[model samples]
Target: MTLSFELTQSVAILGGGPGGYEAALAAAQLGAEVTLVERAGVGGSAVITDVVPSKSLIATADAAVAIAEAGDLGVQLFAKGAHGKPLKPEIAINLAAVNKRLLTLARQQSDDMRAALVEAGVRIITGHGRLDSDNAVVVSTGPGGTDFDRVEADTLVVSVGASPRQLPSAMPDGERILTWTQLYDMTALPEHLIVVGSGVTGAEFAGAYMNLGATVTLVSSRERVLPGEDPDAATVLEKVFTRGGMTVLSKSRAEKVERSGDGVVVTLTDGRTVEGSHCLMAVGSTPNTRGIGLEEAGVQMDASGHIRVNRVARTSVPNIYAAGDCTTFVPLASVASMQGRTAVFHALGDVVIPLDRRRITANIFTAPEIATVGWQEKDVAEAHINGIVHKLPLAANPRAKMMGVRDGFVKLIARQGSGTVIGGVIVAPRASELIYPIAIAVERRLTVDQVSRVFAVYPSLSGSITDAARAMHHVERADED
Candidate 1:
């Protein structure tokens, strides 16, 4: 039961993302001398570029949507100088202000992380850390410098996160052709935006730009947008996007992206071209595995370049572990944190729990925020499970109507034989928050009746979840009759 490692030896963590930093903190708490190395600033891409900045941009767009819908509450609008003329609604989003706030927030996060690590007595080194051997790491400091530092460690945790994958034909110019990481640098809003992928990142940016007063065209190679998410939820999102003046081109593949005189052109595989003021490449991400000495140290990686690691985050090498997007696990901040913590416990020979992917909850942060947990309907149908799926639309919920939310629904999947809830999906504003209760239910194997007994506040959006549970109970009773 002892979680402490020998004080004589030290632990080294590579990359300063959520995974690596969490592991460093845990190791330090367990009385292990820890050294964390990062080539980029602390907090990594999640805090500086991807998650924090995108969510902040979304918050701005949400505020605009709220202001535009104020007339539904019987609020009157009048011009300042005119006698009775109604004022024309305008949403002016200053990109400079937004970018300034983004940088400020990112710096704050970095400072807080550094302070925490320092408080825990963990040494922070700003350098590129690569494994020289199973127990040795070489650090290269200050990009384009000759100085290097090498250190030996008892245990190693690799959490070097993923980077945006770019196609050979579509190199980013940082002005016209941009990646998600570079979008915050835009000072002027694009008049017409062409988004070249339909995954979570693509869909989110497309929806956000469309809401922020830009004409968006979402090009998807698959038959539907957000192919990795629930089919029903994706369908709802596609419908909402289309209704909001977004031109979604499904089953279309972009062969190459090139810059026109003043704009950009995306040539499709089917001999069609789409033009826009700017193009965003959201194809996917690749793990930062190459040139890090993973192969030299005998650490295994998958075909897609993701490091192969066990449930407890151990790699092929006994003392080496990998976590976060670099490992072959669900690429999420929450899962990454858990994987990092698990690696420390397993390495220290403490109480370690293997990762359970089924218990994990994920969300696509679109306008309505699609969130899900546990089994999916497609998996249940493929397995031929006798389960009932119940859906309750937000249209029927009073709280949604009051809040001016017209789209989205809550769906519950339960075993027909036992009426035990096994999976759930929520597509609503703040659906990420709403899905956690259902996630807890599914993880605990709670029955539909048990979920129904929990009182949801009247005139609250979560009431739809309870209503879905009741509907499932009604259907079960009807089947028996």
Candidate 2:
């Protein structure tokens, strides 16, 4: 049912990304006048450049990986040789065609999102938008950005997303040196790609490109890749990387990246150099919150320029709110959308569920994807949570064995005594999908025994989750006895 308030509220959203888009739609549905001001096309960088395109590219790479894995499962492609002998068909990726397909997909999604907002009675302004005050947004629109438009509203939502961080020592030229956004422009895959960081973004692109038939070199300043991820999951990925011919330079930091003839050379902080056809700088991102008049409008921000927001996605200012990467919350597209809706609901006097970090499900899209939710095993080890850990390898799963899957496992963390499921990590193909049920368990505070009672498909990857939960339950019973 659409909310009908006596006084129609007006919502002004700056940035048409996931956060702003959702906020605008929710506000309009609640009988509010919504205006969304966007510099980029609708759906923002998440759709047009970053998330959509990257995931699509990774999907293509995953297809390539499946073809190779298919051979291991006795599914082979063969052609008649000159002497009438069977010849194994080689797996190849036309990266140019793949890039075109993914970009087209991104554009189509952006257009669809735009259509949805329009259908919801939202007024969208295409231009650079900034806070004129807490009550108004000023947009520089039309004809070389000379024309100006102003939107005044009762509530303001800021979801202005973030940009790839660029270092002066290693600047991107959009050719040899590039950011994650510039990757879709390459017609051909990089012959040798040197990824400068080993975080989620870096590991994802590195693994994707390597699967797409590129020599990958991952440079990490830390002792291992995916420094912040579950250590066991990281170990599996690093092992897979090396096994797939990727050069992992753990404990190495790139000081500067310079174009060396046709390729690029990355000089390490310790004075060693590595050369590659292209370099991807996945260092991190900075919020697009600078010069946006946020501070002037009395909205508080952190030292890094991220807008400070409460659990309900509201800023310090009564009428102003912030969401997405620009906010001080967890930087995930899913989290951003939730924050946006919560902000609108709270402002319009509707029911709101405050955002929680433990309830969020996160995934790293690699060959064998790593997905996690709630408190981790490390949290238990550090005495943050009284939890018991249980792990089950996918190799032991009936479906995994049938599919010739040898790597990856399912790990469950439960309350030490009560057996209430608190967190989980899955390292397998499409771990993103597998992690959802665990997220539900965490959110609903389901006990391991309760989860074990639910029947999963006989021969499926998700069986591992149930299997792990049952093991945890057994452990709990043993403790009680």
Top candidate on lDDT is 2
How does residue 311 of candidate 1 score in lDDT? 92
Q: Write the per-residue lDDT of candidate 1 for residues 49-116, one digit (tens) a residue.
A: 88888888887777777777788887655555577666765668787797788778887988899899
TM-score of the candidate numbered 2? Answer: 0.98
Q: Residue 245 of candidate 2: its Cα lDDT?
A: 99
- Leading candidate by TM-score: 2
Model 1 stretches astray by more than 4 angstroms: 1-9, 82-86, 384-386, 474-481
How do all models score by TM-score?
0.95, 0.98
Backbone collision tally, model 1: 0
- The sequence of per-residue lDDT tens digits that candidate 2 reaches over residues 226-339 is 999999999999999999999999999999999999999999999999999999999999999999899899999999999999999999999999999999999999999999
Relative to the unseen true structure, what is the C-alpha lDDT of residue 58 in candidate 1, on a scale of 0 to 100? 82
